[model samples]
Target: MSKIDVDSVGQTREGTFKYDWKMSALYNLGIGA
Candidate 1:
């Protein structure tokens, strides 16, 4: 089977999703933290 590009995950029109503090905070807030 072909390999998937892990770096492409969470890509969007705005930009690629990075695992930075901003994104982590957003995720936590999104989950009602």
Candidate 2:
């Protein structure tokens, strides 16, 4: 249904955001070190 599709998209976006944030943090730490 449309609701399920919306939920899935939201979840995917949130997951990607979290992953990108973690990656950026790691990259910054490596640069600092």
Candidate 3:
């Protein structure tokens, strides 16, 4: 959960959970794309 890094996570990683989406979104936004 808290230790998760969206960049390292993916869509199909067993128990991916929901935070994955959030982390990915944040990462994309952080890069200003």
Candidate 4:
């Protein structure tokens, strides 16, 4: 939960690039699995 909050803050501060990358990576991992 804490890590998620940090990620959310990062998304806000760093913009969408890192967020999108993380989402895409998770999506691909889910698909692969």
Candidate 5:
């Protein structure tokens, strides 16, 4: 079982998803998206 809290997990997941989306958009534009 994990010891992490729900809010922390949610924030981390949200941040990661945002970062990934940003990076993907940048990469796509770089390659003509």
Candidate 6:
């Protein structure tokens, strides 16, 4: 793939992982942990 394509894909993956982490952290907090 082109460099631009690779860069976008990497950025999207990083954003998705960060969002999932934040959601899980909020869930844990809601459960009193």
lDDT of each: 0.54, 0.69, 0.65, 0.70, 0.65, 0.69
Backbone clashes under 3 angstroms, per model: 0, 0, 0, 0, 0, 0
lDDT of 5 by residue, 1-33 (tens): 133233346577777677668768888999997
lDDT of 4 by residue, 1-33 (tens): 466657677366466567767778898998995
On residues 1-33, what C-alpha lDDT tens digit does candidate 2 reach at each position? 455455457577787577667768888998995
Q: How does model 5 score by TM-score?
A: 0.62
Higher-lDDT candidate of 3 and 6:
6
lDDT tens digits, residue span 1-33, model 1: 012235446566344444445567888999999
Clashing pairs in 3: none
Q: How well does each candidate superpose onto the true structure, as a TM-score?
A: 0.41, 0.62, 0.46, 0.52, 0.62, 0.62
- lDDT string for model 6 (5-33, tens) is 55456467777577668768888999999
2, model 1: CA deviation in Å?
A: 20
Candidate 4 Cα outliers beyond 4 Å, as residue runs: 1-13
Error of 1 at 16 (Å): 11
Candidate achieving the largest lDDT: 4
Q: List runs of model 1 lying over 4 Å from the truth.
A: 1-19
lDDT for position 19 in model 1: 40
Prediction 1 global C-alpha lDDT: 0.54
Candidate 5 yields a Cα-based lDDT of 0.65
In model 2, where do residues sit more than 4 Å from their true spots?
A: 1-11
